[model samples]
Target: MATTQSFFRIQTDANLQSMQVGSIMRKVKSRAWKKQRYFRLQDDCATIWYKSKKAGNAHSTCKLRWLWKPPLISISDVEAVREGHQSEVLLSIADEFPPDRCFTLVFRGRRGNLDLVAESAEEAQSWVKGMRKLIENLENMNERERLDQWISDWFKKADKNGDGRMNFKEVQDLLKMMNVDMNEHHALRLFTMADKSQSGTLEDDEFVLFYKMLTQREEVLRIFQDYSSDGQTLSCRDLEEFLREGQLKQDHVQQHSMELIEQYEPSDTAKMRQAMTIDGFQMYLLSPEGSIFNPAMLEQHQDMSQPLSHYFISSSHNTYLMGDQIRGHSSVEAYIRALKRGCRCVEVDCWDGPNGEPIVYHGHTFTSKILFKDVVTVVGNYSFKTSQYPVILSIENHCSVEQQRTMAQHLTRILGDKLLRNALEGKGSDLPSPEDLKGKILLKGKKIGGLERSLDGVVEDSLAAEVSDEDDAAEIEEENLHNDSIRRKPKKSKQGLSKELSDCVVYCKSVHFNSFKHSRIHSKFYEISSFAESKAKKHMKDAGAEFVHHNARQLTRIYPNGIRTDSSNFNPQEMWSAGCQIVALNFQTAGMEMDLNDGLFTQNGCCGYVLKPAFMRSVEKRFDPEHPEIRDGYRPVTLTIKVISGQQLPKVNLKEGSIVDPLVRVEIHGVPKDQARQETRHIDNNGFNPMWHETLTFTIHVPELALVRFVVEDYDKTTKNDFIGQYTLPFSCLQQGYRHIHLLSKDGTSIPPSSLFVHIRIKEGT
Candidate 1:
């Protein structure tokens, strides 16, 4: 067990053997009602018990109400645990309890809250500390251990006979639980295969083997058959045909084919035969040295100690919504999903709620609302869960002063020291490095007096006078709320920030943009500004170099314009080209843009922080996005890829019994006109394993700025072709060999081991 400082004196009793810590009175469904329950924490789960009285003899009885386990009991599960008053300890569970009594633990199988009232503040602190320590320890367990525990728990649940083995019926139910739907005949065949002893049932070891078989794909054998001529082995002639037809240049085809054959058939006896067996074919495809995506790229480390402003941060726009901006439901799950996928920056639009709380949602829209406290709690729990780099909470505030105070209080209490309440190192002239702010949360929003005081502390008097004038204007606006004629007059602009919340603004203070020149003159290290995609593009077109130079010293965020009501995303590469660190996308929506974003950030350890290119980082170097000749640093190259064959290409839009005519389209996305391309040709009818001995080539002028995308689609003449799957990679990362390209869904998730076999070659000049 991991050691942690105890909040109170450790209680040692005979009951400790049963794992029972203590008992307390818990508020039930309503605050007025209370129930007494004893809780026990075990290695894998926590259990609750009830005290029973029989003939004046009191004893503790097991209450099989609910079980809290790892994965399910994530960091976000326990929302907040804080002292309500002197003896009352408030606890909040995410989306499990009633809104009126959210400060209670709602078990999975039970209703209402477990808002326990500890004997004293010290007791409450002890319970909270114990629970948090248990959760943290569970989270810190290695992946293999967690997987083993999960598998063991699942096996126990599915083993209905309690015989430590699973029969056919139980196996069927287990498959259903795993969300795998297989025909009865196929499932029985697999079961029999796994039961090597013919015992009519599967033990734990056999069950694990069966599970692997169910999920594993036969991509290698399928592709090997496609390349073999006699349905047994691939001869030298077969290899030559596969390579020559794959679009390899005539000058290079003969030499490359001979080299591959000699490499696979290394022995003199095998060389005399000039053939590659099944084992050799498998080795060539599965070997890291031959794979299209170099495994070494993932191991290559980059600098992680750069300043926060010197990196392009993976960010999300409207992080609370999962669908259409106007009517989408606001959910804490969105934040969890985004953070888990390496989103370092998240946006929250706060408004006043029905009670004294502040809620997050799209303002002035019909979207659903979630508590601001809930969002903050979720962020605090998940901020460093994926990446230890700092998380920026971009706030769009529209709350009144009272609710703003509630927001500040909840954030401070829930986030604790993780929240940056003040500038670090006494407010340096430059922003802190990512290394300095690791595991911290920075609040970014319009702050009252932030700009004035940040201006060398010399504008304090003028800012004070401006604040007085603003307060007078606010009083007049309040008076006009009662008069008809006065209300008809133009309303005064409301203050965007509250004094209480402003104190939390440390490094990232959102500011309004006036002009490029004006921003350069007034912007401070702590100040950041956002621009709509359209406005940012306009500025880039007008003063591209100036904007680039400005972003070198400070931070600028670019988001999709307001016209994207459907929650679509803009091409983030465009904004990234201009040195904008925070290129916020609608993470809820997935498309080519998201794919590109995923591909770019797939490097740098997917830590949600990638250092800018040297040219972009240097003020002296002039790297213009519009004109590449000014840099002249990139070289022209020809990318030749052959669409050889696909293994278990998923059915795309065809009926259950119908077959699909699969075709591969190769796309090259780059900055120059000659480099941007879409070329498609070959199609095959075999859905399980289709072979198309065709090659497509693209000549790219700027290989550094290019991306190679391979899309698999179902051919249809009547309507548009259906998307099956795709794989996109940076041009710089593409490996040249007989390689396998693993396919991913439109949402950028790996589609099992389904893959396409291709031979790629990159030549020096167009």
Candidate 2:
């Protein structure tokens, strides 16, 4: 029942006529009204309602086409847009203007041209007031220069991003800014005409071209005839008059208005470019200043702005040697302390010591008695008991292949799952080869392609295939037959893998040849490692196997998964780019201590950081504060407990059970041995990895314990023999119950005797 300009209450009963209004209303679901459009209204006399400001123009009225359809533009948008119009228009719109929520306007000029324009009823009323203001401003602005300044200001309002030229999106945003109701597609078409390149960007010249095009398309010239005060200077109010006259019509003015607004939107390519600038890959190369494709650099430093999966600190210099102190004071403990302070990784070279131990020495001969086991122990002590991944303890094995295997076994026995413990385990079928470690937890440090065997000399390929192919249904019968046959000649084997073979083996494993994706391993290695791959391919498990690039520079092409990295040197940025899962912090790549201000201990790959004691100490000093409860509480607390496994326990399960596992024992270290011992409670029997037993839970009795320090020992309970692998947890305790007291003598003397016992040289007798 509502009519267009329904508020006008036309006195004439002009029969209703059909008006062809386009679908200009916004989609119901669009919250921002970005998809809204305009519609027109007409009557039986073709005497359409047109908005005009010719002195005493009368408001016109028309009927609705559909029975229940309401006004095209809502009242809110009309009021919002009108409010943004100049202050003078507000007063005029409030006066004599008849208001309604929906309406359409039609205008005719001397050229016999009819233009149809539509606005919400509220907008129709607002338009009359705005038109009146435009006429008044044109009349008042006697100076053309003032008018020009106003037009420039209006133009700037439409140009967003402050680039001085309106693009399609900018125009759409401008409409939204002013709350003018319009649809997106129509807005796009309107602005594209001045976007001469069709690139969706509008330059000042293009915008000017659009302005001239608008001047030609509408009957706006008469409205602005008196725009210039001195015949040379046109006021902005005159420009508003021109725009208003062109816009309020039944002609092609709406299309022209849309074209003008299209110039405000930015092109798709510009948006894509903006997205690229904010991405991780581009940010990574921003500081190095050139393509990072160099093939020979062992290590390269990256700037801080790069987007990394994890945060890290870089070494001060690219190729600094580590632990070169002349005295016998060099220790992995010192290196770890520095690492804990903040460095993510540290590197060290390994050579065979006199006892065949892998020691920290770059030279062919290992001079320092410190072994690789010592290094792993220090690192595991620092990182275990935290959610952080294992810290990288990269060992550059410069010794013979046999010695490399020895080093690997030693490291594996030391770190458990708490360190990137890489070692070539064995040469025969009984052990894991360096290559097989790719899809698995064990890291192989040497060359690939050779098959490693277990101590029993049984080939791993046959065993793996047998294990994979064996049917679970044949369990009882097979176990009986196998036990009868193997009782006479039992064998045990272990093998090791190198970084290259590991990568190839990992890639070839767990993939189907008939699938779309092919493994990226070199074809030659694929043919050679086909046996392991065949068994792995058949069964969907490839444990800790992962691909590792032979060189660091090859990381330019890899996407973001299934890889680990090891090299003589480490570049956190380059390694992360290459999709390396872990970056080995070798002591030789850079010293643990460089610039105190620079955070050298943080990791770029994962949350794990590997460090020697010295490095860990520095990190602790810098990041961890002293216990506020204690006088000088900021110092990092160190707690060490030694657990002995393989010990037998008496059985009685209580809700608060005290039964100890028969297989383990504890040795508290670093803290006052007695205090650490006092804190030891329950013993747990779980392994970190399903295959290996590494961590155990014990209760702490003291509320003030800060850090835990101790050696853990596990023994063969039945035989009472010492378990091979031992570890320590250091500086991982929070200071909750710690308290300090001044020890005083009976006479109130400040200093007490070094020994608790009083030296009773008691003059004769007490």
Candidate 2: tens digits of C-alpha lDDT, residues 1-766 = 0112232232142211112222233221112222233433332111223221122225534432333343332111121112121111222233422334322221111011111122455444444443333333333432222223333434566765676667676766554432233456765766787788787776655665554443231111222244434443223333233334422223453443333223221334423332111112111111111111121121222222211211222221111123332212344534443344433334445555666665664332122445666665555555432223323333333444355556656555665443333333441212222123322232222233333222222223332222111121123223444433322221222333333222322111211122112333432121111111123222222211122121111111111111111112222322322123233333322211121111222222212322222211221232111112222332432332222212111122222212222232333322121133332232343111011122333332211222222212223357543221222222221111111111121111111110010000101111
After the best TM-score superposition of candidate 2, give how far the Cα of residue 737 lies from its true spot, in angstroms: 40
C-alpha lDDT score of every prediction, in listed order: 0.66, 0.29
lDDT of 1 by residue, 99-167 (tens): 332233422211112466544445555556655554554446432334344455557668997887889
Worst 10 residues of 1 by lDDT: 1-10
What is the overall TM-score of model 2 with all chains considered together? 0.22
Off by over 4 Å in 1: 1-277, 280-284, 287-290, 449-493, 672-675
Count backbone overlaps in model 2. Answer: 160
Residue 379 accuracy (lDDT) in model 1: 94
- Cα-based RMSD of the predictions, in order? 11.4, 34.5
Prediction 1 global C-alpha lDDT: 0.66
Maximum-lDDT candidate: 1
